[model samples]
Target: MDLDLSSAKLTQKKKNSEGINTQILRSICVKTYRTNITKHHIDVGDARPITLPPYRIWSPKTDYITQGLVHLKEQNIIEPATGPWAAPVTLQPKRDRTMRFCIDYRRLNEVTVRYVYLLPRIEDTLDALHDAEYFSTLDLRSGFWQVELDEESKEKTAFVTHDGLFQFTVMSFGLTNAPATFQRLMNVILSGLKWRCCLVYLDDVIIVSSAFDQHLKDINDV
Candidate 1:
């Protein structure tokens, strides 16, 4: 009798899973996501661009960095920069024994104005999930790259490398106000459904519902 009951439970779980709309929970396609620009702002008085010397990269990593840059250029995320402002690129080691490309934006961040947008508190976000039975989480792919930078702001993001100077057309990691900008965009896009059935923190989105049907509706709304 117990075995029969367990099998029934498993069958019900499978049925519930089949009701979910997986595509809605996945990141929006890059082409669609990149159509809109999310400009990063700095105080007018503190907007002077900073230029810095290029840092040395290991010889073996040059090929990897070049390939990555080529890929980014092909995708229109970056272009060759010709401006006075420049930052240095630093390749941080990743867990998979690969290098993660990053810009050393310390000097630029120090001089730039700060955004005061408040992120949702962790406790508050968790508390709102009370009684939620059906949950789905979505992560935006290359989240920051989805939002374009303003033309002037793009020049300010110029970075130096062995290849040459380049600037991002879209938002990149390590900018001081990137989190706030991304959060602001998410809040804008998910305005109506947020707090009611969804929670967004940067690139991560969480959807909650008490039933599978309601979960489908919430996912669609997102």
Candidate 2:
């Protein structure tokens, strides 16, 4: 359901004390739930893929990297790739002491064309919520993985592991233009409701309302 409400008119037929109409609010919810949002994809646009040699990994972390590759493949987050471009992988230590698999895409970013949508300023976002009587924030789990990558751009994200080469089928962290792509998608999904009852910054969605009853309705609509 591509919630493209460009043609739908959601005029409020009546209003409550807070100037909110339940009928219109329900319409907003229906549109949001039915609209099928597009998945995220890498857009190098006019830039061509840059060929680079894969970097070597630490000998001690070889086993971890191999295990991580197997897990990602099992989850369908990545698949075997035989592309000319191969970036190196690194293992970062997490709070639990487990190795966090990461791909170094610095070189690729230099040549990757960027998406130019402007993110909202921090001050402006805060000002919007200053007078709100109720607020709620939702964080998207594995946010990047939620957005799928395009087949054409998957080859450009190929990375080397101890076992073999693989590429992400979903958006991965460290891509230069990923933030812009995500922000653009979020803006589109929240088209009618954005700046009216909510504020979104990447994976974080904040819903604000001036009354308790209206707050609950806003959450459901968002």
Please report how far candidate 2 places residue 222 from its true position, in Å: 1.1
For every model shown, the clashing-pair count is: 0, 3
lDDT of each: 0.80, 0.75
Against the true structure, candidate 1 reaches a TM-score of 0.88
Candidate 1 ranges beyond 4 A from true positions: 1-10, 13-20, 23-32, 35-37, 42-48
- In the range 1-222, model 2's lDDT, one tens digit per residue, is 122333333323312322343444445434212113655556666676666655666788788887888787877889999887788887889999978888989888887767778888999899999889777676666667767887788898898766778888888899987888778888988899999999999989999998767876887788
- Candidate 2, lDDT over the whole model: 0.75
Best by TM-score: 1
Residue 56 error, candidate 1, Å:
1.7
